[model samples]
Target: MMERTALISVNDLNIDVALRQAALGDRVLDLTPKGFDLLLFLAMNRGLVFNRKQLLEKVWGYDYAGDTRTVDVHIRWLRKKIEADPGKPKRILTVRSVGYKLEG
Candidate 1:
């Protein structure tokens, strides 16, 4: 069996990405594969600024030839689940015109 590498903990939430298990404040969060990947990438690189192109290359594992709207959509979805207030996000934050960063 392969060892699971992605381990994430946020407050009461503990998620094992390899096993696809997420516990959020005593409740289990249902996350899609893409969502899980995105969250794991940001959490692992906490406090680092990653532009859309970088995210596309790293997370998607190649240059995304598709629309960049995909990044925005996933970010929105991630914020909805992770942020206490998506409008005023304290975790995943937008860097104005630069990119997005995971706030530490």
Candidate 2:
């Protein structure tokens, strides 16, 4: 008899917050608390665009008074972990002159 496994799997490539706790191939991602939260937020609202200011207010909790580089850094980090090629990503997509979107 073939044994059935209950383990959840998110494709053979990558897994983000929407993918949950599932096998995501060979890529292993270690996220900070803030990074995880940001991923969760984006994953939950896939296909929707969110500006850095909006993300800061919603994810970071409160309006940011400093440089918005924090958002850019986290986005880059997330892309590195989730995208097969961070240079040309499919999941976390950047909207020109706007913000970012999580592609489903």
Using lDDT as the measure, which candidate wins?
Answer: 1
Writing each residue's lDDT as its tens digit, candidate 1 over 12-98 gives 556787787666677776788888778778877888898888888888879569877788889999888877999999878999988
lDDT by residue for model 2 over 6-95, one digit each (tens)? 332233534444434322476456777787778777766778999989989988888568677799999999888788899998878999
lDDT for residue 40 in candidate 1, whole number 0-100? 76
Where is model 2 poorest over a 10-residue stretch in terms of lDDT? 5-14
Off by over 4 Å in 1: 1-6
Backbone clash numbers for all candidates listed: 0, 0
Q: Would you estimate the TM-scores of all the predictions?
A: 0.83, 0.75
